[model samples]
Structures are given as structure tokens and as C-alpha cells.
Target: MKNFEIIANLLKEIWPEHHAKLTSEICQLSSDDAFLLDYIAEKIILIKKDKLKQAIKNYKQTCAVIVQEEIHFRRTQSYRLKTEQQADTEIYSNSSFMDMYLDGLLISQLFWSNHFKVFQFFCSSFLTQISKDDTLNRFVEIGPGHGLFLSEIVKKLPSRECLGYDISESSLRHTSQALQSLECAANVQLINKDIYNLPTDQNFDAIILSEVLEHLEAPQEILTKLSHHLTPKGLLFINVPVCSPAPDHIYLFKTPNEVQDMITSCGFRVNETRYFPMTGYSLERAIKSQATISVAAICQLST
Candidate 1:
């Protein structure tokens, strides 16, 4: 809780006007969730404050690019990229760019109000699933960029074994270091490989693919593949951003319903859906203005 207070004080210093609201929201989190969030905040604040600040600065610049691309999308009604290869060449392969982007994501998950809400939703939802089915032991996470969620899983489910697959070596390294810093006894393996390339015979009790679908050209392909890799009663957690334009974001989901439908079509039955809009905006406002809204869902194989 001390770390949460530290982060709250820092946010208050940065944005004095929202100090009360930010402090109040931080208070809403359960003690364990608060500690996990504080761990991320502490890492961002301790390891490289200057680099994190630079990342935040670059994020504003990147938003300008996103704005221009969104205008093009509005006119064309389509994404700019036609293939995942383009994203790999332009974004993922650029190590320096991804380092900055991933650093920005870590900072955002801690201080960005909307992102914080989405992260809270993810933790709470996962806790609810564990309560129902405490036997979830084998876990796989695709695209574990920041590793905060994976670390939380390891901390909460100390008995589980986790495997994370990511195309970016930078992401794999970050995940590894994050989990190491946590010092948890949970078994973890971080591999630099495309999810599609992983063996098909291995089934997991829980699978996580958060904030990754929009980066791919054919998200359904990955979803369907994951569905086949899930144990009979395994749970799948997914999160996507609608109308959220970023440098690497190729596919676009226009509405929350579109995300749910995509999952259902992939042979997964949606059990719950949660949505969070950009800070200071209502869901309707975010939708009307084509602003960002984060959507998270829990699903299982359709019976």
C-alpha cells in the first residue's frame, strides 16, 4: 500500500486537478491488486525514470500519427496495413521503437486512468475465474508485453506453471525480468516465438491474449488455434481496443459487439464482457467520437 501511496502522490504532483479522484480510484482496488499495481509503478519509477519520461513524451508524438491514420481510416473504412508482415517490418522489428512503446505501456497501465481501469478489470475478472475453478494450473500468455498481468498471475496462483510466447525478443526479456523481480516460486518460461509456431498438441488450463488481436492481420486465426489448444474447460482471457489507433495497431474493431462476435465465431462462448472508455469520456462519447475504448472478455470452448 505504501507503493500505491507513492504512485498517488506522484500522480497528484503531475496532475493536481485530478488528485482527489485519482486517490479515490486507487483506494478502490483490493489490497492484493493494489500491491501488484504498485509493483509495476515502482518498477517504472525506480529502474529508469528518465527513460519512462521519454517514452511518455514519445507517446504524445505517436498520437499525432494515430490521428492522421484515423482520418484516413474514417475516409477509407479500412486499416492501412494489408498484412501482418508489414507490421513486423515496420513496428515489431524496430527494437528501439518497441522498447519505448513497451515502456510507455508500463507507465500507462499505472498512471493512465483508462488503462488502469482496464487492468483492474483484467485482475478482477481473473480472480473471479479462479474462484470458480481453482484447478487452473497450466497457463499460457501470448504477447505478454509489459508482463504485469503475468506477474500478477504468478503471484496469485503460485502453484501454476506459465509459458509466455512473444514475437519480440524485447518483450520476452522484459517479461522474464519482471517475473524475476517478483521473486515468486511459480514456474515461468518466456520464449521469443510467434504463437502460431507453438506446438499444437499442448493444451493449457488458462490462456491469455490481451491487447494482441488488433496487432494481427487475422486475429480469428490465432483465436481458433488457441481454442484448439485449450483444455476441455479451460478459460481464455482477451482484451482489445476499439477505435484505438496506434502505430502498430493494424486491425480495427468498431464496436465491443464486434469483438464478442469474433470470439464466438472462433468457437469460444463468451461468459463476460467489460468495457472502459478513455479517461473523461463516457462510452457513448468515446464511440461517437471514434475515441479509444478498451474491451475485455472471458470465454471458454462452446458447448
Candidate 2:
């Protein structure tokens, strides 16, 4: 059986209630994305098979929590992410809690339709941009949680120098282990540093900031910093969720336009933008219902 099939069976056996919905989403995956998901499944089996069941449980529970939070958001029109200090104390500082959270998030990129589509957008749009630009050689991904984006970079653009930065040592370690399992860590450097501490003189030809903006207290500051670090002809791929409520998410983007405006105002000229509504919600319906929507944008520095 393919790794994805094996893991699907495992999820079915453990979470029968979610089987039909998950199977539907799996069937909707494109061939390339399905392959990428299989690759991730194979790595999980190799590295964390003993903990796979628990991870799936965590993912299911997290989904439930998000559903409730989304309900609250719909009622209040505000996200639960009130402050960074709360996130630091309640989510980031608790190692065991983060272990479960990260494990669930890794699975989310595979099964969550919006998350999967955002990754697909990154793979198609960002990679195509870099492949056509010979000058785009150096790559950096800020807050490369789970190492999926960096793995794609090192795999497709093998000659490109790559860097991954995270403020948490444990998060960096998790990302490193993920790359190591895929055997793509040979050319990728994982840095234990805050985004502000990144070397000012070092500019990169490509930068990826996926699902990171929502976690920050001031996302515009990081976006501005990224603009300064990008090469004159460099491209950036960034993903942020609108109306998404999570334990660690701080900044709340209320709509796709809001997300786009924030990026454009932060010294970027938007090259392309794709908005992916969560599964079972159409873009219009999501907007009308105030549902979560993932906004993926490809940008260049505004001259």
C-alpha cells in the first residue's frame, strides 16, 4: 500500500467519524499533491510511527477546538489571539502542549483542504517564479514550521542555498529532524534566531513566510524587514489566514482584502494572490459567514 493509503487506513480505524470527509478531501488532491502527502506520510512512519495514533487524536481534538473558536469568532467578530504574551505563556512555553500542537499541524497540511491548497499554491507559483529567474539562488523561510516549504526548496532547487529560522530552539529542532528524515537537510541550514536578529546585510533571492503572519504581534514589521532583505528581483511567498482563531495566532486578518492590503502596504507589490476557503465553504460563502480563509500571496519588493 502507498504510505498515504496506509495512513488513511489508520486514520479511518481510529477516527471513523472523520473518515468520509477526509476521504473526500483525499480524492480531491491533485496527483502531485497526493505524492507530496505520501512523502510526508512515509517520513512520519519512519520517524514517528509509534506516536502516529496519538498525533491523529491530537489533530482531531485540535479540529474540535478550532470549530468552537470559530463559533466564538463568528459571534464576536474577534479572534482569540488577544496578545503575544498570552501565547508565549500558554502555548509556546509549554513544550508538551506544543508537541501535540505541532504534530496536529503537520497532519493539517495534509488533510485540511485550505492548508493543502495553500501548500499547492506555494509549490506551483513560487517554484515557477524561482525556476524562471536565474538570479534567484539564495532562499530563506522565516518560521518554517514542519520544514515542508524548505523541503520543497532543497528538493527542487538543490543548488540554491537555503536557511530556516525560528525563535524557539525546540521548534527549530523539530524542523531539523523533519528535514533530516527526508534527507534534505544536507544543504538546508536551520537557525535558532528571531526574525529581527536575521543578518541585515544578507539579502536573499527568495523568501517564504507561510502561515506565519497570524502568529505575530506586529506582522507588518516582519513584512517590512523581509522587503529590505529581498534581492532587487527576488520573490516572496506568504500565506496568512483570515478570521482564523488558534491558540497561538495573534494578528487577526478579517478578510482577504485586508491581507492583501497589509502585504502591499508593507513594501511589496503583489504579483499574485489566491484565496482558499476552508473545506465545505465556498469563497463567497466563507466571506459571508465569516469563515476561515487562507490567503496565499506571491510578491516582489515595491520600487
Candidate 3:
């Protein structure tokens, strides 16, 4: 409660126009769900309070860019991020920019309607369903930015060994700090490594790749590699945004079916799927208008 109050106050001060709406949306969350977000805010504030205001401002700027690009996409039916070179130049090499971007994203996970709802599906659906399996003892998350999913994995499956892989040391560091702040890093190993370089023989019972697909040039390759890394019966959770245009997003998925098709093509069978359209838009309206719609899928390797 205290942490939520402090962070909410900070957001209100930094972005007064959006704060009331954020508050209204947050009030709709179940008490337990609300507490989890508050707890996350506490850890983030403890870790980045010094730069929190700037991060909020950066998020505002990031949203502005996305809005402009989204308009262009709707008109042109093309994403501005067309090549790997652009992503490398604009996103991967810029350390300060990435820091601000990551900070804003962490806040978005808490306050953004679609993002929060997708995470809720992850918690109530995917995680809950997987928790039924007593044999699931090992877990890995690719690009676990902000450590929310990793921490939740540890909390839900305390006995499972957890691994988080990310190419950015700063991103991994933030995840580590977040886990430690939540006092759940004991079973987590944060590795500064890329998925392509991971040992071939290593496998996991569950793998999480959320919001990372949109950043890749060839998502199919990564998904294929992940399939190789998953045990035969392993479950994989993927979250991607369709018709979403962001500064760093490269791969453009046009529909939810495209996402599921990609999964199937990569050797995974879609077990369950959930869609969360952007706030203020219904699923049908979002699809018709080409608005951002998040697709969260739970999958397993095909026989």
C-alpha cells in the first residue's frame, strides 16, 4: 500500500493528465492483483528512485513515438522498423536509451491496460495450468526484462530451478535487482547470454519468451531454437503484439492467427490462446482498426 501510494504520487506528479485514468484502471484490479503491482512498484522505486521521474518522461516520449508510427502503419500498412540494421543502430547500441526504455516498460506492465491484462492471463491461465504438473521442475525465461515473469515463476513454483538469459548486461542487472528486492532470487540464475549461443543439450520444462519476439528480425529462428531447448513435454509461453508499432519492434505480425501459425511452424502446438486488445478498444475493433492487440499463447512441442 505504501509503495503503491509513493509510486502513484510520483506518476501523478510526472504525468498528471494520465494519472487519474491509470488510477481508475488500477482500481479495477482484484485486491491481490493490485497488491502484486504495488509490490513490484516498491522494488522498482527502491532500485531506480533517483531516475524515476526521467524514466516516466522517457516513457511518455516512447508512447508519443509509438502513436506516430501506429498512425503511419495504419495508413501505409508497413512498419518503420524494416531492417535489422535499423534495430541495431536505434535500439541495441544505445545504452542510455535502452535504460529509459526498460524503465518505462516496467511501469507500463503495471499501469498499461492491455499489458496488465496479458500478465494477468499469464498468471491466472498459463502459470496456473502449468503448476498442475508435478514433473515441471526447471524453468527458463528469454529476455526477462524487469524480472516480473521470472519472479512470479519463482513464487509460484518455489522448487523449480529458474534461469534468465538476456544479451544486455544492464537488463539482466535490473532483473537481478528486481528479484533480489522481492527476496526471490535465491533460486534464480541471471545469465548475460544470447539464446543462440546457449548449449544445445540444455533443456527446460518450461520456457517463457514474452514481448521479445517483436524485437527480433527472424522470430522463427529463435522459436525453432527454443523448441530444441524444450523437453518433449515442456510448455512454452509466448506473448507478442500484433499490428503494434514501437520504436524497436521489427517483426510485424498482422493477426493473432499469424502468431499461432508461427508457433506451429516452429514445432509447437498451441494449447491455449488469449488476446488482450489495447485499452479503449475491443478485440474486434482493434483488429478492424489495426490497433495493437497482444497475443499470449501457451504451447507444447508437437509429437
Candidate 4:
């Protein structure tokens, strides 16, 4: 195939990863599709098909990091070191995926959770922050993946009504199945809907936004709108990736203070916040410290 044809095909398959350097290099290959393939194949090693499948699955499902080179030749973009890898799975690029075609990959890993402690802390702290009273009634958890945290809540406050919201139908299915297995399905309600325009007269006494804000387009707008869904004096428990490098994480809250400011700007009073850091290596590093995962809770005060 000609290089131009190859570029056209790549654009049709997946959205071009908006990296300026990569795009420029790809464009430079213009009508040399074979050369581009050879170029990529020479650069590509160890990364496999199953891994790429796994990486895409991981990314679409939960938090997955895409590691690549920060190549910049001062102002202009240049490609030297870059590879797309799944945080805990595999690595591949546009050419690699097409060589194998990713239609047969299963989408079941959306519920994968290897980091339970972080998820645990994220769940418990969020709910606790929102419930100022001894009792936490009428709580809503957005993006309740695997429903692991939902089970935790059922154990702590058995009488309270807990609702889990997610746009992914598969995720909702996992939530239902997991909660049903624990026999806590009765205490939770899972809904599949767009949260941005959720038409509900119902207001939650406590709202959970655990590590969800970063994946959004305008997180501020979402939080701003959520301000009203919370009942007066209602508590908003939120968890955000303070410095995690994930492809889907658009908003890199460099510090806990930045997150606090965003929440405060939304008219909430910050009560308490903590950072859970996690770090990763360049596949070359012997070990990468985990960046701090900041967990904080704010209250929608009644004036």
C-alpha cells in the first residue's frame, strides 16, 4: 500500500493520537506506507498483539497508562522515542493493531482491579466524608467499577440506600453481578446514563466522585452542575489522580491544592484531604514510586 493510503486507513480505524511529534513523523512518511511499516517494525520489539489487545481493553475499562517519549526538538516536533503501552498489560501502535486487526478481543476486563487498597480507601473515605451524620442515607456513587467499594459501603451502613451510576453498560453489569454475589445487591441500585444531563428531581445526601473527574472533558462544569444535585449541607466525597499519567486522564491535578481549589470554586467547603502517591518507570527503571492518590471530601453548605 502507498504511504498516503496507509495514513488514510489509520485515520479511519482509530482517532489519531493527538501527539504532535507522532503526527508529524507519520505525515513525513506520506506516500511511503511500506517504509512507514518498516520504520515502525524496526522500532517495535517485545510488544505483542495479545498485549496490545489487553492494553486497549485496560484503557477503555479502567485506569491505564500510555507511556511514550516526550520528544521535542525545541518548538518543532520530532519523533525519536515513543511507544504505546498498556499500564499493566501490553504495548502497540496504530500499525501493530492493523497488522493483527483487533476485532476478536474480548471486552471482559473492564472490571479488572489489581489495586484494591487504593480503591478501598477511595470508597470508604468518599462516603465517610459525605455523611456528616452518624447515618449516611441516600448516597450515589458515579462510575462504580467492579462494585467492590459498593460492597464495602453495604457492610458499613447496611440501612442506607446506595446507588451506583455508570455510562458503561458492561461496567453496570459487572457491578450488578459483583454486588449480587455478595448478597448486597438489595442495598444498591445501578444506573446506566449520561451523568452530565441526568434528569432527576432526586438529590443525594452524599455523592461520590472517586477518581472520575480526570476522565471528563470539562471536569469543572460537571462538578459545578453536581453542586446542585447534592442536598443542602450534603457532603461531596471526591477522589482524583493528583499526578497519574494515563491516556484518558486529561486533567493532571499536579497537587492536592489544585483539586481543592477546583472544588472550592464549585462553592464547596473543603473539610479534609489526603494524597495517595503512585509512580511508574520507563520500562527501563528498576522501580517507579507510585504517585500520591489524593482523596478529599467537600461539603455543599446550606447558607
Residue pairs that clash (backbone atoms under 3 angstroms), model 2:
none
Predictions in order: lDDT: 0.77, 0.84, 0.85, 0.53
Cα miss at 268, model 4 (Å)? 0.8
Model 3, range 167-232, lDDT digits (tens) per residue?
777778778887887789898998988787999988999999999998888999999999999998
lDDT score of model 3?
A: 0.85
- Over 4 Å off, model 1: 1-40, 46-78
Each model's total of backbone clashes: 0, 0, 0, 14
Which of 3 and 4 is ahead in TM-score?
3
* Span of ten consecutive residues with least summed lDDT in model 1: 47-56
Which pairs in model 1 have colliding backbones?
none
TM-score of each: 0.84, 0.93, 0.90, 0.57
Query: What does candidate 3 score on TM?
Result: 0.90
Q: Specify the highest-TM-score model's number.
A: 2
